[model samples]
Target: MRRSRFAASVTSLLLATGLALTGAATAQASSTAATGGYVALGDSYSSGVGSGSYISSSGSCDRSTKAFPYLWNAAHSPSSFAFNACSGATTDDVLAGQLGSLNSSTALVSISIGGNDAGFADIMTTCVLSSDSSCVSKINNAKAYVDSTLPGKLDTVYNAISAKAPSARVVVLGYPRFYLLGQSCLGLSDTKRSAINSAADYIDAAIQKRALDHDFVFGDVRSPFSSHEICSGDSWLHSVNWLDIGESYHPTAAGQSGGYLPVFTANAS
Candidate 1:
């Protein structure tokens, strides 16, 4: 059986037998339902590694305490949440790993992925510092991959999620800008930033298209963050791009709060 189909069966069985139980908890935000539940899934950006403190099982990916799930949970109180947003997740992770525990009662889902597939982070690590003649080529390669691959991945993810929980409202999250367009720094350059953001725009556009195709909602976070670079005053994401070493591509605590909260709240209805 397909993984999504099997999970759906399990969910049906649980709901029928009343065997699968969720512990009741209350968040400070407004209660949206008699019982609220969510299953968050995605890559490092979803995990909050570069943004803040780690929370889930410590793999190199470093899921964070201040990730979007936390923000959403805070906004919607008295909800059950299963945050399986491991670092470095791809579309396959959502279809297989994230949906395995899903059920009909699941109210919402949010995802942020495909950065790894397009090699966005790798592009930064490789071309951001090295003044190589091939830097532009590498950026171009990342863009090409994202443009070609993201739509299919979106289809697969949306299909799998909808199959598992037909009633759940799916929200696909987009990557935030990691570079300052037309600006340069010590280790990173504006060119690389522009390239990455351009690639992100492609991915986000693909996500929005998929959302429309599948009747799911797409959250476009790029414009609201136009002037807000990573290290800028009250930025929504972390300053990983400017950092000389360590993880340099994730949201900051404030970034998640400022950028993520509005979307989560808007979509909850």
Candidate 2:
């Protein structure tokens, strides 16, 4: 009877050990399956150009840890993360270089494009350094481009992304107004600031339309940055950084965290 009882004790221990091992394996498999794949593709804003503390391996892409994509991924811990956003990327540049990152396995995709295609940098330079009339003329030219040519370009890029990542939830993020309306700072008049804001609105409208037409999500950042524009006392965007021109007019870390990340996280599924 003593031997029989000892044998039963060992059998119960072995059975418990097997059950624990099986539970562990099942839990690991569930975790793996829950971790979805994510891909980020777009221009400077999406790349975190002004947020600083860039990833050295990203090179000129200027990807920052403070960028919305990285922040989102860190919080969610996706199974696979690909950051292909580059500084100065236009719609065409994305089509040529970035779309390769998207595939059927990509469960989520985020992009911020069309600003460069509108020649925003040039407009800013004109508005900042040149006369008011010069700024107006440059802005008008950009608006013309947005009206005439930008729609087709956006359509092409959106279609390509949808085709490449059929399974992915594509989110196209829009640019924010750089300055508050009728508020002047850094030598910019109300007219110039309004023009810049109008341009931003134009770009956002075009991008939003394209996103909706393609049945993708459009993340509008304008409302989120409404009170944090350049003229705001607590501005989240960087001003003209002569030392680092690339950082100029880009979002600061505060903007990335407070202004951009929340909106992205809300839309990212």
Candidate 3:
């Protein structure tokens, strides 16, 4: 009986130690995964367009302290951080400009691109100012570009990223749907709003496909921004502001924190 008791005690102690060790290992690994150099790349969405409080040093690129990349770096204290994303950046722009600052030391990267490539500004301008038929035509043109040419452009950028940051975990983020469908929005009619949302979905789908093809994580923000889209009572996005035309149709700071940041945090590994 004495021997059996001693054996049982030893077994329990071993199990406890093993569980503790496993937990420690998990914590350490998570820390390690999030600790290396973080490089932010791509366009205005990543650079914080409507979020405001832009980094003065960033000039026209409009990097914001409120941006998800800046917020994540602030929270995690990565060994190094390079905010290379710019406003008005297309796939070609990223390919030419943003590929710097990525290296083997980079443990994580996040990007939001392909919107400008698909003529985001043009579509918005047409939708807001032109007839509903014109808006639909513009959206259809954008969709065609997304379906045809954007894939190759995205592939080029993704390939360059892989080459530049050979070991980094890449997270490719998608834009939020512009409007809450079935809700009463002021500017655009439901037809226009629905078409715009459909365009957003198309862009996101294209981005996701290429991200997956490159073995990168696709961070979809639509789900997070669902009830909080522009037409929602609690909207996270900015509708057209004639005062600051540049800030039109972009995520507000809340969208960055409550939407994009959380999605990135969940998928940063």
Q: Write the residue-wise lDDT of candidate 1 on 1-269 in tens digits.
A: 01122233334444565540011212234334326578787876677665657764655556666776765665564367887887667787667677775678877877777766666545654554456545677777876776787778878878888888787777777766666655444444666566666667777776678787998777766765666765355555554322312344556665665666555555655
Q: Which of candidates 1 and 3 reaches a greater TM-score?
A: 3
TM-score pick, better of 2 and 3: 3
Give the alpha carbon lDDT tens digit for every residue of 1-269 in model 3.
01122233434433555520112212322254456899999898899888889999998788999988888887777899899999888888888888889998899999999988888877776676579999999999999999889999999999999998888999999988989888766778999999999998998999999999999999998998989988898988887544455776788888888888888877886
Cα-based lDDT for every prediction: 0.63, 0.78, 0.81
| Ten contiguous residues minimizing lDDT sum, candidate 3 | 19-28
* Arranged by TM-score, best first: 3, 2, 1
TM-score of each: 0.79, 0.85, 0.87
Prediction 3 global C-alpha lDDT: 0.81
**Per-residue alpha-carbon lDDT of model 2 for 221-267, expressed as tens digits?**
88879888998988888765544555778898888877777767667
User: Native-vs-model 2 lDDT?
Assistant: 0.78
Clashes of each: 6, 0, 0
As a TM-score, model 2 comes out at 0.85
Top candidate, metric TM-score: 3
Candidate 2 stretches greater than 4 Å from native: 1-35
Q: Where does model 1 exceed 4 Å of error?
A: 1-34, 56-61, 240-246
For candidate 3, the per-residue lDDT at 148 reads 89
